[model samples]
Target: MSVETDSHGRLYLSSELRQKYGEKFHIVEYEDRLELVPIDEDPLQAVREAAGDAFEGESIEELRERAREQAKEDAEAGFERGKRTAEGGNE
Candidate 1:
């Protein structure tokens, strides 16, 4: 179906289209065209779907602890790498 924008350059979707797709959309613009992508209304559910089983049996507290430990390890590794770089080491 063909759609047109108003004088203000705003396009309106028909109720049929809205019901078929969604109320919320992300407009992607290419050099020569525009496309609309439907967005999930429930953002947390979307994240859960995308994450899949990555967090499987882990509790929130366990995840937080793991994140903190990983951050500390990353900081220490970065510091050691910087030290070695400053000392002209290949490590």
Candidate 2:
């Protein structure tokens, strides 16, 4: 239940405490205190770790570009799948 500040003076989760909890927790800020809620390891870390620095502190323009790229990829994938299905599911 201690407070910690990062290099930029922003609050940060304690790595030691997180490790002690076996990497299964959710941090919630309630009123003036921080609360830790236990969550299963997967949902707790999967999305975040998978996401990585993809959008970390990115600006609106950068995020829009990423979104555009993702949408283009998705559309291309869908078109490929449709083409395959139309072609009797050929590889």
Q: What is the TM-score of each candidate against the true structure?
A: 0.56, 0.39
List of clashing residue pairs for candidate 1:
none
Which regions of candidate 2 are displaced past 4 Å? 1-54
lDDT of each: 0.90, 0.75
Model 2 score (lDDT): 0.75
TM-score of 2: 0.39
| Per-residue C-alpha lDDT of model 2 across residues 23-53, encoded as one tens digit per residue | 5557899889777786756762555577897
Model 2 residue pairs with clashes: none
lDDT of 2 at 75: 100
Candidate 1 Cα misplacement greater than 4 A, ranges:
56-91
Tally clashes: model 1: 0
